[model samples]
Target: MSTAHDRERAWLLVTRREVVSRITDKSFLIGTVLMVAMIVGFIGFTAWQEERTDEATLGATPEAVAMAQAVADAAPQVDDKLEVRLVELDDDAAARAALEADEVDAWLHPVDGDWQLTSESSEQDSLTAATRVVVRQQVLADNAARVGSTVEELEAGSTVGTEFLRGDAERAAVAEAVGFVFVFLFYFAALVFGMQLASSVIEEKQSRIVEIIAAAIPLRHLLAGKVLGNTALALIQLLVYLAVGLVGLTFTPYKSYVPALSGPAAWFLAFFLAGFVALACLWAVAGSLASRTEDLQATSTPLTMLMLVMFFGGLSLDGRGQVIASFVPPVSAVVMPKRILAGGVDWWEPLAALGLLAAFALATVWVGERLYRRALLQTGGRVSLRQAWSAAE
Candidate 1:
């Protein structure tokens, strides 16, 4: 005699119970704390790396002044306080000897028309390329001055110029970061929580608790409620993690808020939610299909492969070939946002992508619920998608 509304309310109550049970668990609280700690530790590590050391050892010979002057000419921005030591090396061999003896980090030699720069692998990070640039510019400037030619004339000798056809520097950096972060987070969060969904369903089935619940509630309602409960749990965890990460970002020294939230950022946030819901529904269906926790590994393989494809596909954004990928549901949430962050996407791209993403999400959840109702109560064996679909008849 109970109405559909009554059944839905009962189902919601079950979901609420599950959510409450999970949200209050000790492991959940501990995991949240550890996540915060890791964020703080990462921040500290970056600060330490930036502030730790500044060491450079420059070696010279009879050509030391010339070489230094050339470097200075190439890059006039060199710090005046940098120490340029003079070494009276007899030849290239003597310079090599000085480097071998740790007397200098790098040796400079004036070959016939060019300078031979040598440094150990250990000195690579410390040695700035500006040293070589300054030297080259200084040499060119000196020659031009001797010929009574202007610096402008000297510059005209170099015809090559860099061009950016699409976006500016800020946009480019944002796009790169967004693409990498979006793909990584989607892949990571889906795998971690998707497995939890599968395992939870299988556990309930194995314990025979689900069979008892099915007696009072329709099998479809029971399965939908379970998926809804686990999804709520995942969303709660995701929000908490996002809040902590934002706090960490505020404390850290990142300078690009414009790209982080503007143009592509807003669009990305919209699609990411749709993408998460769609993927989560599929994960729920995956959970319902498995008969035991052990079967989850094999059953969830398809979802894992799909996630991997979406993730790796986003990596092609650099080549501007991810345009197609940006329209796909799960992939688009990550890819389109990245393109927007990078300033490569048109304003309408997000709107179009979100529309498709929403349709997919709705369809997936609808189908997932139907499958759950049909397969959840089936005992002693796993239910294939084909079997679950046919059960409606």
Candidate 2:
């Protein structure tokens, strides 16, 4: 008689069948399309935001051209470049006419050696604020010049110098957004796929299919095939996302960011494998503990909770917290990527994390195989952990 250990063909066939079944599933197809759409939409939205910046139109009299020049010299806070389009007019009437006709965002006219600005709304925009600052500075200089003194003299030579510390924080907002996307995608996908492995195991057990399959194939092969097949699908989905994302990034000006992000991206894949397998084994264990979908909640709740903690906790880590996560299994997959995106990660962290996670994954597989062999044949009701533990392997 051919036993599961006598030959690997039966289990290999089982793995192939599972991979084909999942890849051809209608829900999987729809989910893939939706995921692609969301990622594309996100990339499009980012491109739009990068292109959109505040613009200001300034209407000024021919004599008040200095006001426009001052506005031009002051950079708007939005893009660090002031877009002050000057519409020259002969008098205040023409300027007001332009302003009322929406020809300019705001207008400036000279009155008895003083300048007055007119706008449609009380709320100030970046351009408007910049224009105000320039006008004030110019007026101060002019007042000092009238008295044969300088604006500097009036300030008593006290100038406040403010410096911006970009230091790994310059791209903070962007990094945080991208890292959130990366972490959450991995976090949610891992949980969903892990549960899928569990549900498949339970489904096969509940249908009594495992009895026939185990009779023909070793229980270990069966367990390995199920985990391998689902993991392959999960990886295909993740790679698709990464490829689409890279393509999108290439189209945008942010393509330069790819090289820096690639390391973390690679780590994400490595950790994802280790993390998924570690969790996937538990999922298999969870499935073997239950005979039906209804019975899965109690068995799988701990698995779900562990994933949730990793997801939320990974989001909260900083420098030291992230380093600590790098040594920890599963969550390290997420934490390390975030640090990479944030920049300033050490060189050895990824290697260390990957090693630790791989070790844990191997241990999990051992335990999960034992659990599967013990409980996969038990039926009719929920199989408690105690019962499965005491059952012959």
Candidate 3:
């Protein structure tokens, strides 16, 4: 009798071989480097947007130099990113020339005891806000000096109070963006690795590799090993990506903003494992159904379309629908993690979803075994699902 331990060792050897093969591939190495670069570039872009420190050069004529200086001094109070560097312009002609040259974002002119700012757009938000505050303070100071009063006393005008009403549904926009990455990453990973899984199976079967391997181990063990191996690779790929993202986050202004995403990240990985396992089996089934590499697309279209629905459906659905989707099998494996970030997910919700997903994955494995067993070596042409299902064992 084949003991459980012997079967474990046998399947483990198969899994180890697949993992080694995938990681050692030249394409995987190259792809990892490219993925790293892409991750860095995206992180840098997001960090730049959050900082908004793009310098806006200011050409200040002699008359407005003092006001510009005042604004520069008050820049810290307005916005840390708001930088004002004064460029001395000799005359109006020079100022216009500076503007034309695009050497300055705006020409600051003092006309008739008021500041005039000439820019491409009327709305120069940082400049406008800083100038207004400085001007208001200047006016108050002048009045205080004339009346023998303090600027603070004169500036104590009517107050406007503000408050925010937050609800349970109100999640940070940044959090949702992070969650989208998690879900969408899984969506993409499933498609890519799923196809890879199918291709791997097809290649082996075509080369008669599966027959040689199956002569020693049970076909089911070989199947389990293949699934386990590829699934490990898929997970490692996601973890590498997730690690890169988290590390990248630390360098970004979003670092502080998105730290709370750890909870969602954990949930994402949990669902990712289950979802990919289910998808990976179908991928293997697709491979089993196809006779040649050319037949892969045609045979796998149904399963490919199924995952595509999860991707597109995730984009269109929200709230109750998304919540409902979290519990559904393959969809649950992708969208539910995002729902955890996007809404008030109950503690029991993930447990229930995971349980259901586990059951579905097991069912998929059994079906995948059936498909793989009946059709894997019958490689004269593409095998129909009906024929594979009803064909004699």
Candidate 4:
């Protein structure tokens, strides 16, 4: 009974209402504020922890100052810049007790003919190695001068200058963390909110709203409007969070506190937006399959399972996913970004992945519209993925 004009107006009204509700909703605003607060609190907590640790270990002692001066006087590399500490224990038992208690970074004692170094189990290897070199050189010079040996005879063997061929350790570590966070965040967000999109569609359909919609307008317009409306809502939420994060980073106190927000951050944000759009359309279609809100799990289980596979597969991207994973929609979001972050993939790789995902998402939206039309009128029993696909045909 409704005219095309009436149906078009109805669709617009529904979509506008959704946009307004999402943007102005009390719960959404509160949730956004809480998320921002949590992020800022985490950053502040980590800095406090690091500062306390540095304060505990980096201080000077009288005996340590004397020993450090002696070592510095012997070796050029042993500069007096380091804050050294000493725990002058009466015996090895006392030293062992102090080490067990973690009261010092290192302890020096006289061995049979040379000095002995003792420290806690968790002492930094690099610091310990540097200390040993300084002390050994000083001992060697004193012994050699007593026996009239040459400087060359007392000098230790040369150390190799190791060069990495494929990757630097710090770079690799940063790349891996960036990749992991991007992939995981993308996957989880898609899976969680994507299902919400699906359920939203199914609820409207079950209530006979789609029938009223279909009587006046084409099925395609109705479906497209719904998907667009939901996608807009999700994007608005993401942008707000990102804006809060950027604002927090601008403060000078948080200079070293922010995540590396340079090249990788930019790329990761781009990929995340593209990936969200690609997945959200398909999820909207999945939501249309259910006749009732309770039927959602039955209809959406396959897509949910696919999302899970993509999530777990992302964890192994650096290890197992080199070639085969770069093109599979959900999994590709994780894998391709990982390769790019690792500096292991070409620039063209992300383009190819995005292209594939876009194509797949469009195809899914088409199929989903057909299913939405068919199932929009059916209710009472469960609607399965097979039934939805067959209805689309």
Candidate 5:
């Protein structure tokens, strides 16, 4: 009989082979580079878009320069990043020339004791609104002086202060964004790696390599090696992507979301490992049932559907349903971390959910091992789950 140490060595050799083959594959390396580029490019694009300033130049006759300046100063109150620049015009003809030459976004002058705003085409609503407010304030100040009162006194009781009953609105928005990221990463990694694991298993069988390998090492060891190896690769790739994303985020306005997301991100990785292992086992079983690559789709339909449900559920579920989903295995992998990020969950809730996921992973491994062992050597056609379960070892 093989000693425990020898069995450990045998399985470890298989694990090493799996890891080496994947890392050495040209396609995998190329895909990693492309993904990193996409992430960096996206972050750069977002930063560029955010940093761009909206500028509006207005041509004003000398007399209206002060009004234009007031509009410029007040424009930020309407939209913080808006810049209204004033260009002096000698007369109406100069203003018209400036508008025709695209030297100004609009033209402003006095008409019939009221202000007139003219543009070559449609005017920006924000600029129009800001100019209206400044004009109204100037008129109000004049009226106030006639009545021996101040604009401040007339507007003192009109300002409204905001209050949030639940939490900071900005923080809540950040949490929602973080939760969406978690859901997407989990869904993507699990589906990609799970399918890869299944394909590896079926390919080995198709080439008749598994039979020779199985004779040397226990089938359980083979199964363990494949699952653990792929899990490691999946985790490593995920961490690299997340690291790149976090580093990129530091240069964006959303960098503030980092601290808020850090805790939940860590928990997500932990839950991901357990949940991935469970799904990996099922994927292995799916592969073992297939007699060829052509049958893979037929056997893996259920797993695909499950992943879809998890994806949509993580994004759409809310209220009491969300609370209940945080305890369910697999789905909990995404939901529990989201709830934690959203706040209001007790600390024990994630711990309990992780515990349940771990247990489910263990159970899947046991059942999957039996099915894989029985169906791996069957060559003529695809094997049904019941036939695999009942087959003699």
Candidate 6:
């Protein structure tokens, strides 16, 4: 019998081999570089879009010049990025010419003691809204002055304030966005790495290399090594992506969201580690049960379906359903973090969820090892789960 120390060394060797081989692989390195580039490029593009300003020019006849200037001055108050420039026109004819020549986005002229605004195509909403606001303010001020009062005095007690009885709306919106990122990361890592692990197992079994390896070390150690090694790689890749994304967020208006997201982000990583181990073990079992690459699809369908359910559940679940899901293993891996970020969960909630996930992960490891051990040396075609379970050890 192998000593405990020997078994530890044995699995470590397999794990080191797995990690080293993947790190040295050109495709993995290239893929990592490409993903990083994409993240940086996306963030850069978003920041550029946010910083870009929209300019609108309005042509105004002499009688409407004051109204046009008022619109220009007030436009920025509504949207800081909006700049409305006034182009003084000699007459209505001149204003029409400016509009035709694209010298101004719109034209303003006085008709029947009211302003008539015309644009070449559909009216710009920003300019239109600004014009409405300016017109309303002018009318209100005139009325207030006629009554021997100020606009502020006339509009006193007219404004309404909002109060949130539960979580903050703005913070919850940010948390939802952050939760989406976490869901995508978890789904992507589980699908990609899980399939890769499954494929690796099937490939080794098909090549009969597992027979030689199984003889020298326990099959349980082999399974443990592969699962842990891939889990490590997945975590490293996730960390890199998250680090790049967080650093990129600093360049955008959403930088303030980072500090609030930090705690939930940490919890996501912890849950992901446990959740992925469980999924990875089942993937290993899926591979061992399959005799060839073509057979992998049939064997892995259940795992795929489970992942899909988790993916959608993470995004769509809310209300009492969300609260219930937050306690379930694997599903809780995504749901609990989202709830924490959205607020209202007790302090012990995540801890309890994580405990359940950890226990589930351990159970999967034990069960997956049993199935993997029985099926690893089977030489014929695909082995059914029942056959693998009943087969002699």
Best by lDDT: 6
Pairs of residues clashing in candidate 3? none
Q: What tens-digit string does per-residue lDDT give for candidate 4 at 294-362?
A: 777766677778777877787765455556786777567677777766765667877888788777766
Writing each residue's lDDT as its tens digit, candidate 1 over 3-111 gives 7787768768778877888779898678767866876687677556644544556666675656754553433246433434445566677777888888877776667
lDDT of 6 by residue, 257-316 (tens): 888777888999999999999999999999999999999999999999999999999999
Q: Model 3, residue 99: what's the lDDT? A: 86
lDDT of 3 by residue, 1-393 (tens): 566677667878888988998899999878877987898899999888877874557788887777777776776577777877778888889999998888888887877877788886455788777767876787688779999998878657766765533323234566667777876788778887888888988999889888877666777777888889988988888888888999898988667645677888888888888878888889988999987999999999998789888887766677679878888988888777877776567899998998899899989988889988898878688999998898887
Give candidate 3 regions above 4 Å deviation. Answer: 1-9, 44-52, 60-76, 87-91, 109-116, 120-171, 257-259
Question: Model 6: how far is 121 from its true place, Å?
Answer: 2.6
lDDT of 6: 0.90
Model 5 misses residue 346 by how many Å? 2.1
After superposing candidate 1 on the true structure, give the runs of residues whose Cα lies further than 4 Å from its correct spot: 1-7, 37-53, 69-98, 112-114, 120-128, 157-159, 163-166, 244-253, 258-266, 317-321
Error of 3 at 14 (Å): 2.0
Order the candidates by TM-score, highest first.
6, 5, 1, 2, 3, 4
Model 4 lDDT-worst window of ten? 52-61
Residue range 9-123, candidate 2, lDDT tens digits:
7667767887999899999999999999999998999887777766678877888887786776565543364466777788878877887788877777767876777787654
lDDT of 5 at 296: 94
Q: What TM-score does candidate 4 get on C-alpha atoms?
A: 0.74
Ranking by lDDT: 6, 5, 3, 2, 1, 4
Task: Estimate the overall C-alpha local distance difference test score of candidate 3.
Answer: 0.81
**lDDT of model 3, residue 172:** 57
Name the runs in model 4 displaced over 4 angstroms. 1-13, 45-82, 87-106, 111-158, 162-168, 205-219, 243-270
Each prediction's whole-model lDDT (CA):
0.69, 0.80, 0.81, 0.63, 0.88, 0.90
What is candidate 5's local distance difference test score?
A: 0.88
lDDT of 5 by residue, 1-393 (tens): 667788778868778887998989998889888988998998899888888778899789988998898888788887776889889899999999999899998988999988999999887776888788888998899999999999999999999987755467877887887788889988888888888888988898899998988877898889988888888888998898888888888999889887767788899899899989999989999999998999999999999999998899999999999999988988998999889988878889999999998998899899999999999999889999999999999
